[model samples]
Target: MEVHTVSETPPDRPPQSGLVRALKVPRNAVIGIGFGIALAVVAYLARVLELLGPFAGTREYPVLGPEGWFLVLAFVLATSTALLVASVLTVVEIVRLARTVDE
Candidate 1:
């Protein structure tokens, strides 16, 4: 029988926790699929609400104007970028997990 104890000393291969664990999700392809999906969903909603680029100028439209479009685009881009990066990290984590020696 063998027992492994948790200690402050890091393992030769560090154990994952928190966000690291989240990134290790095996399902993500890490090719920006989630980012693309989320962006599409958001864009669809914005268009449906008549809140896209055409209405982005707040001063011109007083509602859903240029500012609105800029805000929406900025938000969508930022969120998609973050998700894409996270997805890539998840891919790396999955690969690392695959290579780890299992007890």
Candidate 2:
């Protein structure tokens, strides 16, 4: 013979543990990583095409030669892009968390 208001209602699910919360990643970060991987694949394909072209092995880069230099550059590009995207999304998530906490 009791009635409960919304404020007194029990939660549907139990609270998450600290470790579980910490391990969770925001959706934006996952999307950013996916985009980064796609970009890396494109970069690798481009390198392969360039190396297979008519000028293959004809020219040399400064330190590592054409093949090595291209590989390094592609790696740099992929890493930087992924880091940049993940950082931006992380910042956005932090801001969102702050707003919710303030409420």
Candidate 3:
């Protein structure tokens, strides 16, 4: 039987591959993504408000006519899609980073 004690195990910080190091995300990129997500949320709220607020009282969404509503919906979809993509990328990057650790 073999038992690996904590003291015997390698440190959590391990050498990273050249490709991984090259691809490592910068802090600014993460912050940018967060800001993007926040922007998306704000847009979503604005869209909902427009739909349910004063604009909605005019001739069944006159402010946002059929075409205009379509555009807003598209914006919402785009933001949500961006959020999803960012989240997935972040998770994948985290996993990749974790794999580099000795633990």
- TM-scores vs. true structure, each candidate: 0.39, 0.54, 0.42
For candidate 2, write residues 55-85 as lDDT tens digits.
5356657877776776777778777787788
lDDT of 3 by residue, 3-102 (tens): 9666876777756755444555454356546666666666566665665464434456578675577567756766666566655666787777778884
Q: Point to the candidate with the largest TM-score.
A: 2
Candidate 2 RMSD to the real structure? 11.6
| Full-model lDDT, candidate 3 | 0.62
The lDDT per prediction is 0.63, 0.70, 0.62
Candidate 1 pairs with clashing backbones = 55-64, 55-65, 56-65, 56-66, 56-67, 57-65, 57-66, 58-66
Candidate with top lDDT is: 2
| lDDT by residue (tens digit), candidate 1, 1-103 | 9999889876586456554555655445344556665666676567656675555543554578755665667577756776776667777776776677462
State the weakest 10-residue window (summed lDDT) of model 3. 19-28
Prediction 1 TM-score vs. true: 0.39
Query: Which portions of model 1 miss their true places by more than 4 Å?
Result: 1-62
Candidate 2 off by > 4 Å: 1-33, 50-59, 62-64
Off by over 4 Å in 3: 1-61
